[model samples]
Target: MSDTHRWVEIERVEPGVFRARNARGGELHVAGDGGELFTPVELLMVAIAACSAADVDVITSRRAEPEELRARVDAHKVRDETGNSLRDIQVTFTARFAEGEAGDAARAALPRAVQTSHDRSCTVSRTVEAGTPVQVLLA
Candidate 1:
């Protein structure tokens, strides 16, 4: 396996708001108080959904290009005596393809593709399932 580490830098834009940028220079805005931008938890959900969708899309496209594709992730958060955390997460994916032999093949492969992504591929989902270690540093 290639040992490449990816990094994202987060900077405070203002009270309760921040901006994060990846090494590739892609940036996103985050808010802590449910502002106009995405919150951290929402971003996490997006990451998971996007990762799975990407894998599914590539696999499905190999059989037949989808005319339309969309993925949505819903998470339930619980806060109690123990602490606050995501209690459950659900992912839904939809794809539409042209009517033809290719479309038939793609339709047949869609379920397997999604299953493979959730069970094996989809790094973000796997990471979440495995649990991640976090460290904080003062700068």
Candidate 2:
């Protein structure tokens, strides 16, 4: 299988602010601190949650439209010998289905959908869990 190459160009917008643009022209602002823009750490959590949500949504929505489905990703910012990093990362899901046969079917599939996403489908969560190393290069 061929995987799409993912890359983004982060251009400095101002002091402590940057804009990340993907090849398709999507852009989002980022910051380290002191701004409305999402911090890098927060973006990481979003990635984990969004990736799982995508996988789970596709699976469960096929059964029935979701009444409500959301994931909350959180972690503790810690400074240790390992330097600044996150710990105790958690991804919590809140899903609700309406009272109906279709809803019941969706409900039945919810647990499996979430598990499959976490265990095998969500690349973001898997990468984080695997402790993938980053190779930084100077341009």
Candidate 3:
């Protein structure tokens, strides 16, 4: 087997809107207001959100009782001295669960799940931290 970068193609659906298909046959839609291009940072944000949700789902499913699960992840990128790529990134994860006796356990597992996503699973997190550039514009 050879190392090959999996191909995912994106097509411009409309002004500032795009559609993409992943290697795993997943389709995604991306759009923006003001007819501006969707920056890679926005994709990173999407990735973080997706990963956090995936982690929460895994954790919640392992529990004995089926508890409602929800999560939010916020990431901030610090710029380099020369205003080039991102220098540092901080991500915060918040997870909420249905009321139950295992509430504490559920809460405690949130961090672990996030860590797993960041360290082991999330391709978006890994890609962003590895070197993908991110730029934010204020409307």
Best by TM-score: 2
Q: Cα RMSDs of all predictions?
A: 1.3, 1.1, 6.5
Worst 10 residues of 2 by lDDT: 32-41
Q: What clash count goes with each model?
A: 0, 0, 0
Which ranges in model 3 have alpha carbons more than 4 Å from their true place?
1-5, 23-26, 32-40, 64-88, 132-139
Each prediction's TM-score against the native? 0.93, 0.95, 0.60
- Per-residue lDDT tens digits of candidate 3, residues 41-137? 6675666677767766677556533344544545455666676444345565555566775766677677777778788777767876677675765
Model 2, 1-139: lDDT tens per residue?
A: 7688889899998889999999999999999894777998999999999999999999988888888999998889999987999999999999888889988999999999999999999999999899999999997
Q: Predictions ranked by lDDT, top down?
A: 2, 1, 3
- Please provide the root mean square deviation of candidate 3 (C-alpha atoms, Å): 6.5
Candidate lDDT scores, in order, read 0.91, 0.92, 0.65
Residue-by-residue lDDT tens digits, candidate 1, 111-132: 9999999999998999899988
